[model samples]
Target: MTDAFSSSSETVLQRVLEVSLKSNTPVDKLEELYQIKATCDFILEHQFAKVALQFPDELLGDSVAIAEEINRNTNAKPFILGDTSYGSCCVDEVAAEHVGAECIVHYGSACLSTSKRLPLMYVFERRAVDVDRCASSFRELYPDSRSNVVILYDVSYAHAVKDLVTILSPEYPNLVSSELVVEGERCYSPGFIKRLNNDSLPPEQCDSQVIYQFGRQFSLKSGSSITDYSMFYIGEEGATLRNFMMTWNRCSFCSFSPATMTGRAESISVNRALMKRYYAIERAKDASVVGILVGTLGVADYLTIIQQLKETIRRAGKKSYMFAMGKLNVPKLANFLEIDIYVLIACPENSLLDSNDFYKPVVTPFEMEVACNKQREWSEEYITDFRRLLPGGQSHVPLADQQDESDETDVSLITGVLRSHNLLNGEPAETPSSSSMVLRNQTLTVANTNSAASFLAGRSWRGLEQKLGDTPVVKAVEGRRGIAIAYEEEGTAS
Candidate 1:
């Protein structure tokens, strides 16, 4: 047993050390992959004085070399950013703003969420792909030449997509390839824009012909619905594939992995994910206290959605608290035992948190909306992006009025107990003037009205205690201390 434990410990230590080591790549290949010349041109054209270069953990091995090259070519001062405040996929605008950087150049895999504050650029770091192999795999999986299909790919493999389309388009005329929307470029598809402005068109005619999700956009052929198409993504398995699977659960989905150089059909249970989200919504509806966790500051209109969620919770007669903790973990969230449930307001890619390790259920803004707003109805069309819940978005669901049955009660599905609708009444629960005794588990205890405060009070270790007058005051004395690593008394004790 001891030998096995020691071996595992040594393996973990080696992996930790390996993370700090840098992997070397040739200079010319690095420059071509990162498009150093294009980045230098962008900096020069913008006349930026200070630029922050952000790289995800995997790509950080080459960050120093890339920064030095950019500094040599461009007049702008370049600095490499360390660990990001939130998800690495997001552009760490908050970190860039702290250094007063005029712009940011992000590298590696990105969520491509729109940044609100700073001007940003992305370098996908082009990856190699065998177009012929991918073409052959596509034909095998999709034997029918007239099958309705849409081709989407990871941004790293984007450069080879044009070649793949050229090779496959000749035989398969129904094949469509989606385009990635870059910064400072037109966002909405032509069909989407046309349908939006044409209010006089009938309901069926006004429905969008273009489908947009995350950073990619594609239009369907006239008279064909989105449900009629099958999605084929080219990328390694990760959050991007999961997001695509959940968002378009109705469509048939498959993926091609460039690393393995093989194509395989994905059998992700989209219904299972949606069922879990629905369960979270039901749990939130029964919660008396909701903690609104701010997961991002870079995504556009985050503040607006936070405010909207707060108001919605208020109208539902529930208590809410806002937190801005950098990144969420079990320990950070566990510290707040008072909160019954948590609502995470983050970018679409980072919003869906796996709550298996969390003490309480964590829900997204859309789920919170369905729980608090009586007007909204649950549907299979799940939305992870908080922006879509904002006013004027396609999935926007309005909050219920304050006067709508504020005092009604409903039975909780999980706890089979009647819960009051107006338990908090849009205010913090206050301690009653007189305490009542209750028998719980054969023990008699004084019951307090403020459940949150009572929970903290019951904890044995309730932080540091402040005894104002119980303890006698003592004179100040010099303490033996040096630095944190080594104390002054350590040498004398030795």
Candidate 2:
């Protein structure tokens, strides 16, 4: 008994795993690692049993490992779901082989093996159906009644499957419910789902519940939508942002990362640009928009609240735009939402605030501001090739350039105040290999003991109140002195 107990405790699951995650890491990370791996293994084992999905031709590079994993698990004589690379039920022989059955069938075929209904696996790859005869003849021989359909596809394809689950849930609740697993999470078919928009439904409900509980376990609250009414007021869990999620992008300037995320940038840009375009065109709102549904206000709980706002706006007859904010690591949201332009604000740009690191030093705050100003300038400078995305000639956006504002800091310290934070060439991968990469921020200047812009190369201090007895403030521009403020008691206004 003692030996068995000791051995079991030594396993990864048994480890006490007392982790103190930083604000940038998921607090429930250790537990998620524990759960995500186990779930993946279970699904892999079942898939290994039957259809034997294989690697498609488009897969490149070290997919050999994935191919080999498929080969090692699949048995010979497994069924083929399809031939096309991206077709629905588009699984290869090896990935399918990881399923519990020897035959991988399309949604129509999936219904016959067990009951009046069955696991209608939802996959992205499409293929021709063998509608000639029912599988009764084959089913009679195997005599198995279980229908375990697996819906395997990239998360990029989630929106496609989103509607399908609505119908699938109610149509075959028990049959479909028991059979599906997606991305290591229990995925319910749309038919089994009673309502497409409800937050309380199964699978999605379970997903949110788990994430919320786990996020809290790590001392993080997922970010939620910010509303004019909810400002400084208590909000539901979903509408609040996770401090850690914001920090995960871990920008020292704004809450989220900017230049690093292309999709996010594009999405935000496209939405805003498109809206200006729509307004310019004087597009009239029609009654057709009545059927449109705004995103639930509380969506900030599960998804990025900013993105949710864009979707809600789109539904309300505005142009499609992506929302900003969050520590999202995937481009799926940006792509799925059809965003074209993204504007980021996580650098030493605009107001005198500085973020030491958005991690990539090349993109500094001043640099980001420069980039944005350049884009706007270029738009006006060369509107020829540029399709006027926004309908109007120019947009009147709220900017930090309020006329009444002034900086009281010493003018010498604010060098490069209008510089851009992006690469001169604007290459996507902002860095060269280690051969050319340099820690540029190390050379940047910050306020020091005498309160001059001394150079420092590390994380920034919390808003200047702590380090200096006095903090800088915007002045009336009466004397024209800049970047320094006359020191005062703590009660002085910023």
Instruction: Please report the candidate that would top TM-score against the real structure.
Output: 1
Candidate with the greatest lDDT versus the true structure: 1
Per-residue lDDT tens digits of candidate 2, residues 1-494? Answer: 00011111222122243333232324344222112233224345555344322222332222223223333444222322223222221222222323333433232111111111212232222222221111222122223334221121122222333343344344333212111222212222332212122244455333321211101111111232111001010111111122212212211111111112111111123234323333321211211111111111111121232333233333222232223322222342322222222322221111111112222111111122222222222131112101111223233212233243222211212232322222121222223222223222222423111101111222265224564647666577545333346433333466
Show how many residue pairs clash in every candidate, following the order shown.
Answer: 0, 85
Question: What TM-score would each prediction reach against the true structure?
Answer: 0.83, 0.20
Question: Per-model C-alpha lDDT, please?
Answer: 0.76, 0.24
Estimate the TM-score for candidate 2. 0.20
lDDT of 2: 0.24
